[model samples]
Target: MFDKIRDVILEYVELPKESITPDTRFLADMHMNSLDIMTMIGQLEDEYDITIETEDLNNIYTMQQLVDYIEERL
Candidate 1:
């Protein structure tokens, strides 16, 4: 799941795959703004066949948090 999530993120960002760890922050570390985050979320929703609520996003900042949220929905 982590690998899949990383792949989805890779489609939007140019960073090396190795640098995207569970602790990497979408905002602070990857410098993803609102549009970038929403675009990535759309991809993820399509890839995982899950709907991620906007309110749920407030608590998610790191890669692991996103992974965990998707896992729980699945």
Candidate 2:
């Protein structure tokens, strides 16, 4: 699951595979904007059949955090 999410983000972002470490910050480290995040969230919702609240999205920062959030819905 994490790999899939990582792959999708990597497709649009320039970050390397090694940079996807658990501690990497999505916005600061990966340089993702809100649109990138929303798009990824949309893809995740479609793939997992779950809705992620906007408030919760803001709280997702690190790679581990995002994976945990997605896993909860999964």
Candidate 3:
């Protein structure tokens, strides 16, 4: 699950793969704006065939958080 999430993040962002750690914050560490985040969420939804509730979006800040959320839903 981490590898899959990492792959999507690597494809979406310009950051080097090695730079992304579980602790990496989406905005602060990865340099992602709102649009980048939305796009990545969309891609994740498509990949998993699930919709991330709008309210849940607020809870996801770091790479670990996002991966954990998806893993829980799975």
lDDT of 2 at 18: 78
What root-mean-square deviation over C-alphas does model 3 reach?
Answer: 1.0
TM-score of 2: 0.91
Candidate 3, run of 10 with poorest lDDT:
9-18
Model 1, range 1-74, lDDT digits (tens) per residue? 99998988888889999999999999999988898899889989998899999989999999999999999999
TM-score of 1: 0.94
Q: Would you give me the overall lDDT of model 2?
A: 0.86
Q: Give me the runs in candidate 2 sitting further than 4 Å from their true place.
A: none
Which residue ranges in model 3 land beyond 4 Å of their true spot?
none
Encode model 2's per-residue lDDT on 1-74: one tens digit a residue: 87888888886698778778878898888998889888988988888899999999778899899889888877
TM-score of each: 0.94, 0.91, 0.90
* Prediction-by-prediction clash tally: 0, 0, 0
- lDDT of candidate 1? 0.93
Query: How much does each candidate deviate from the true structure in C-alpha RMSD?
Result: 0.8, 1.0, 1.0
lDDT of model 3, residue 40: 85
